[model samples]
Target: MTYRDFPMPAGLRRTVPGGSETGGPEAGGTVAEPAPAKASATVMLLRPGTGTDGLELFVLKRAATMAFAANMLAFPGGGVDPRDADPDVPWAGPDPQEWARRMDTSVEQARELVIAAAREVFEECGVLLAGPDAGSIVADLTDPVWDEERDALLSREQSFAELLIRRNLVLRTDLLSLRAHWITPELQPKRFNTRFFVARLPEGQIADDRSSEATEVLWAAPEQLLAANDAGEHRMLPPTRVMIEQLARAASLDDALRPAERVWPVLPAPVEHDDALWMRAPIDEDGNGLPPTVAARNGDRPQGELPVMTPWTGGPLNERVTCTLCPNPSPMTLEGTNTWILSAPGADEAVVIDPGPLDEEHLQQVLTDVAARGARVGLVLFTHEHWDHAQSLERFGELTGAPLRGNFPGAEPVTDGELFEIGGLRLRTVLTPGHTMASVCFLLEEDGILFTGDTILGRGTTVVAHPDGQLSAYLDTLEKIADLTTGSVTTLAPGHGPVLPDAAATVRQYADHRQERLAQVREATVGQQDRPRSELADLVVAEVYAEVPRNVWPAARQSVLAQLDYLDAGS
Candidate 1:
């Protein structure tokens, strides 16, 4: 219940070693039961200001020394004091019973949350929302007398109910609208069941950056703040970031005040991958990252930009198969690698393909899922040797003791067109190298889905990862995949990205993209035909990849080198 003023929990570091406050499960030891969440509240104070929507929000940069979410940009909020439930407190606007219905909490807890929201906003920003009566709001709170009262409240010298009693003021519950509820993930040392509120800036009163908890303060448009976050100026917690994103869609203050259809508490859990930890949380399917179930995006999505492939915990693709997405996300790994679990209807055994990155939590998740289905891992298969999809085989094999096969080290060698049967389902492996000499695809013959491992992807073209990836061999692999997809393979479940409906069409797109790149490379070598390989690769990247981000230019160069080799060999 009480954590010392440290950014990360001490016990967590002791057990998780390199882990931070991202709250990943302990790698080497048992984690203590998570502490209960303290009921808390925060408010997004809004007003008319610069930007397209003519709306701006008040924000504070928490002091770096804070125990939780240190140095993050946040709204004004604090925990509910036990005294906030005082029976004699002034009342106004919607009563606690109505709020209980709105906030999905007990009438008593709703009252406490509302009181905490008003009290913290006033205590932290010096702009009180209550007045002597329900009909009016307090104005001009910049005087020293008000400052003394704020200081008293901050130091707990006076409770919020006492301050309201002294001023003969009633809490303006109507001014605040319930926006969202977010519970801190259980992996945290300090957790909060936080109720979020949105309110307009009271007229004739100015908010000041006088809160002792904040080192800096600002008022910016929602879009501007998002741009800043994208540019890495200020870091925001997921809750705050999501709220601002919603606010950016507003055309006016009335649109901002519009009630939400529904609010669900989002709790983000940590998932480890790519030798690091990333937070995994659920998002609406239509809003942002269309979670890979999108059967056909080719006709819908824009030409150049890929749809937001938001990080997700993948779900069941059909009756016999499920994809558990790893929590790793990056430009290189779009929404992390996919780990497929295949079984028969009501079978007690399953086949797990690509256990994915050496994340202790992910491994446990896979095992838990297998057990949940009343099944044990009958076999483990790695599509390739790339560390992202293949490294955890040894640890996983130890845990499951299942047969290990496919392109990983110390696994049974897989030849082209080998059949791996499990749970009465036949999975035929088609050796489609190129991404690596060992890359392969698994055909779930019954379901008509081909799990393409890095040879093709859901979002964009697969990177032919240089010397290890030969362009000529990769082209052959694509052709082979295209031919096999016609008869029974209707869907493509790519190893790294989305699962699409038309497998054959996607393969053709990959082929077309490859040829386009080849043409670009040939054109780039117009006058520099005799240049060194490295120089030629760099030149091709500049000529062909000018529109792409510089961060990915290194990867583009590798692909260019492969194209150069393919071209040189042909000549």
Candidate 2:
């Protein structure tokens, strides 16, 4: 296994993961492996001949011994070679100037990068994107005479374009389009200004991966790949993960190809704090729109007067914010991932709470917004260390230079009664265990808001995750939160979904709902013939939460396990 270590250009300091302006948040330890910088390309190859053939991406699994992407699934391309810049080759479409302007590189350099990308694609994948000479009995590129030229070019004995010109083959710039760019975050020594590209696999040629960089290769549909990744069945870098997620939404190859031609630049934004680190891409174009304004978490108007939310289906992106820039009724996955921007009321130096996912773009938008406010981020407060929420902490903190504060250890976990001061706001931590042992919620005195990670949510019921998520402890924690609401809690801010108007009512509903589910599960299991755990879960899910998706039954089984443990303890 060959391991390549590519270093970044000198004098450029590595800041946050996603090209964020550094020096706000304290540095967190490196999160994930430091990705080696390489000018690699991910070709989203399409076969336009038959619509039924669908979209197929050429993919490779790096050899386990390779230094950069060892043992990982990847696209077919590698670092740029100097020979790719030769000026003698017959050209296809767009001139180098257009690419240079778009890529923000010198015309000479941009030409070389594109050449390298094309050359590497052909050499490793065996898909010759270059055009065949007119009226030739055989494709000039496949001729045995050209093998020496190809080998010499690969070995840096000759220029790629010179090899092409010597054999009268045309370089197919027309076949490729710029997709996005990614830079490895600064925390690690290895970095690359990787430029991803897209192209169609030409006619009469099948991909033959020649490099030993990858141990295996396959061409799979985007949806299949994303499913495998989501199910923890495949490994993908953050960029690959996001692109696959985006591509899965498209219906056909044409739909996917149209977007790639638009030249969207993927900005690397890694947010970091004292305790965590991760990367995300920027969400939108910088300086193209007005900066978002931070809204007070607690509104002055009454809950009934607040605009009634018609359940949004376009996911969290389309959700509307009430008199604030942050989305209200933030859409969430089953686990209830609630995200909030904690700005000082009428002040700029606010804190961001629970920047969800290691999404590079969203983190970049966050830093851009923070910078626009004329005040940098002061802190990133985590509600818990669950994979869904806290994974991006290190990146967010590193980008903003803010100290991270949470209820768990490392860096600084807020004590059961510790108070955190950010700008003019004060957040009091309540050590509410259960719903996964270390769960904690924060009471924002400035906004009268409670930021609950997963101990509570605004919609649906939270299951005691079992073993790790204890039922008894969770129930006890709920009772305690209910106690707070009964006294002064007016609004409910949960980790998942939207904020609620009535805190006390919501807490009571949560408690009652869990009890109801447990009771139903208990009834279904009692005096029945012994059954497998999967069978018991299926029966209990249908009986208790018929509204929940059947696909989530596996998750429900964990909850059912806890409920059974509680019932058995009493028996």
Candidate 3:
């Protein structure tokens, strides 16, 4: 599938008038400011998969009558109850103080979140996460007496701790493991700071759709659920969708619950443009984010400092740069296209790089920001002719009445080492054609920043976009950019994601990754020299790129084909 065809999880933004990119109330809108997120907890109950299934998670479809996330598939969870904060409740297993350290919350709040998770699991799914003692779990909870207690708990006639005490059971805090923490976006009417936990379904108990809040319940493999969601047959919130994607990486319940030294909270920032909304999650150069699964697998530990993330809220990045993030975010574009404004200090004329797509609101926002900075657009430039990076070229030039330059057919052709001056700013075009034939990188001679376009992304590797994108040329471009990094290029102003601090290291890493992929492709295609090109590409993908998701293999196939072509030409 193409980048546009890739499915993205639905966001939670409610339609509002005069909303800005960050979903804050606009100047003339009557919409009230969003309220703070209420503390909540959720649990993903897992069990061994049957037949060809992998690990399956217990999920429920919320009733359509609910106030929030109505008619959506979700794990059992709810907001923390006031009674959940009661320290007098009977408990067992891990101490609340230890749980506090794990969850990055206060001891009282950690106790409440864990209690709420257990309470909601029983209240919604008829599976209690408690046992008679600290070392054991309740094997069976199907008795009618248990049903009465669950009903009473759900109705608030009795607290979860009270139910546990009456049944002579201890809340099994050790059974649950932290999966993730997601805060609802500010654009949504209702917000939640939900901590997600994963736990094994007790041996002798079954999860039943017993709660009035849910319309149905089922056990589904994580991959199957993701496929259904991708096919539009199932609907889920962004957090739920991302969690399921993470769960798909695990082969068993033990793998899914592997303990991590630290888990970073995923706070998806909201960006709105031209009536379209997206939740932008921060990711690294490999397009990998702090998904709990990734963290757990690598045993990542929180240190003194974490990687810096560029805010989705459009604003000045520095004295010479300003970034206005577009609202279109997908698997390929982490936070959306970063429309950059470059100007020298105290200069009244600025240069706009990569106008980005044809979104009128984004184009207008760029102009508004430029005017706000007491500057007029002096020149418009393109890094390549790819629609995402250059579609708005003429429109922006029309609006700013600035001269346009790029490697495109009609625009002023920029050659390697070609220099342009915008006020006191000096930019030299460096031809870097790997992503697209026309791709180029701009060097800010004085600022030590490189406008890398798609040749280098802030949060992931760029696709060679085979046929139009040559692997040999792309490799050369990576080396060329890496050589420049040895000098003054300290920061990378990429077309997507954030501004990277280590430009040279990133370039070298990109080159190394490309070489590794090339070697893998060469090895995978060995002794298949007589095979059809299409067949060879498929074999390469199956053997070399087997771990990549099938949805992305189409693009991967493109790169694989490019690699094969490179190898063939070399031979």
lDDT of 3 by residue, 1-571 (tens): 0001012243323221111111111110112233346689999999999998778998989876554676789999988877898887778778899999988899999999999999999888888888888888888776799898887886567898788778788888888988777776554434578898999999999899778888999999999998998788888987787788878887677888765545666555544335445555543322223655443332132221122222445457678888888776755655678788988777899898888889999899889888887899999888888777788887887898998888987578899999998867899999998778989889988889999888877544677778888988988898888788889788888887667777775675566557656766776676788999999999887765443346566777777777888898993
| Candidate order by decreasing lDDT | 3, 1, 2
Cα lDDT tens digits, model 2, 1-571, are 0111122212222121211011010011111122234444556565543345467677788775443444667777766655556666577777888878767678877887788777777667666667655322123345555455556655556666766676577777777777667655444333455777777777666776566678778787777787887686777776666566565666776676652434434433333335333343333322011111211111332211222223322222211111112232221242234566665545567766677677767677667655555567787778777756677777877777788887665447678878877656777888888777878787876556677776765344555676777888888988988888866566666665456666775675456556655655676676543777667766765554333345445566677778777776883
lDDT string for model 1 (399-428, tens) is 999999986577887888899877869999
What RMSD, rounded to one decimal, does every model reach?
20.9, 21.9, 20.5
Off by over 4 Å in 3: 1-314
Best-performing candidate as measured by TM-score:
3
Q: Model 3 — TM-score against the truth?
A: 0.49
TM-score of 1: 0.47
Return the TM-score for candidate 2, rounded to 2 decimals. Answer: 0.42
User: Which clashing pairs does model 3 show?
Assistant: 285-459
Over the full model, what C-alpha lDDT does candidate 1 score relative to the true structure?
Answer: 0.73
The stretch of ten residues in a row with the least summed lDDT in candidate 3 is: 21-30
- Model 3: how far is 386 from its true place, Å? 0.8
Per-residue error for 57 in candidate 2, Å, reads 0.9
